[model samples]
Target: MPYRHLFKALQWGLILFCLCFAMVGGTMAERLLELLQCQPHANPALRSCAWLPNALGLRLAPFLSAGGISDYPFVLLQNFWALIAVWMVALIATHRAARNAASTAALPDRGKTRYPGITGADAGRWASRAAFWVLLLGLAGFCMAFGTPILGNRVALEVLGALGCSPGTFDPFSSPCMSAPGFWTHRLAVYVIPLAGPLLAPVWLFMAFWDILLAWTLLTAAAYILQDHLSKRARRPAP
Candidate 1:
């Protein structure tokens, strides 16, 4: 394929990312297991598990502190990997489209050529649609993050109530609802306040904008590659 080098690069990048993710996850898991092994009546010094931190490296102390691993780093890493995966898929689709266009161009009668794979126009259109939806979702999240506070806690409480969580018993800092079995409710409880509050709102907004920009960039690149491939194919004489 014309994008063979680019595809290999992406594969190596993904491998590196996975290795890093595994290291982080394994270290965190080991630390958690050590804490769980400590007896309730054990001495404070013995239960402290100082050696675990040392083994994991001093630089990770902040993340390993407070009896748990930080979720932010893991979330960021997962999202980054997801973005890379999407980009790789887009590149593969673009390459396939280019190949199909070339094959189509080889026929003496272009009108009679039956394209067996995705066409350049189709790939570009799908990429554009994906970009639009990503932007729309990002904007919606941005609005929700900023508007939740203005909407007040009543709306939040109502939603929580519908989820079988008691509004009167709900405590944002130490709520069991935050770690509920259901994914949507758990995420709602854990992130709604942080996203709406002054402390993390700016950070969330920045990440949201970053996501939008990445999606747009990916879409633009795919479109450009497809157009270039189609144009080159058009200029080639039929065999």
Candidate 2:
């Protein structure tokens, strides 16, 4: 029982970690863009030179950023890829832990009441719930990372305007006058492409659905492991 509780704690902790990790990366990318924009003194040639903020972004920069003023797609894709990697790692680890716990639970007991913990049916149920929760959580995480900074920047723009910072042409790291609307428009590409565009050629749907399935699989494994441990503890000799 003690270990079972620990397993649950770990599962929750990992999910939180993944969420935070994703948010952090998103924040970094957003900040980098802001930083680039603020550097008005940069060389003329370097003005338009914007690097991908994340690894995946860097990898797909050439293909995605083609003819685009802003490479928002790369940034979003990086965050998406990072989230998936983290989630997959956590799921695999949890699955292994669950398997071990289940095996331990099957050991012969001297004499005690044995109660079933996680069963095959339980796994299916738990997975469904986990998938739902993960989907919501993932959305929140992604938004916090990718959207919050933009919102903050919007506020900053308003405050600057109030303080007398005049808006100028939206230039890449050149003119101090940055167009928030333009920024948003450029960033919107990241969302539009996957949600509605023809980039994935229908593969996007599968990627979107993968989250739910992945979450279910991971949580089910964790639940089964913890339940098995609890079941084993239930049959132990009581003093």
Predicted model with the maximum lDDT: 1
What is the per-residue lDDT of model 2 for residues 1-239, given as tens digits with 9 covering 90 to 100?
Answer: 45456557767875664454334544454455455453222222233333222222332323333333344444445435665576566666666767767776776773223545567756655565565556556655543433443443443343333222333433332333333333333332222332233233233333433564476557656666655665566567788
Per-candidate TM vs. native? 0.29, 0.30
Per-residue lDDT of 221 in model 2: 63
Checking candidate 2 for backbone clashes, the offending pairs are 168-177
The parts of candidate 2 lying over 4 Å away from their true place are 1-57, 60-96, 99-103, 106-118, 150-239
lDDT of each structure? 0.49, 0.45
- Candidate 1 colliding pairs, count: 0
Error of 2 at 27 (Å): 29
- Each candidate: how many clashes? 0, 1
In candidate 1, which residue pairs get closer than 3 Å at backbone N, Cα or C atoms, i.e. clash? Answer: none
Summed over model 2, clashes come to 1
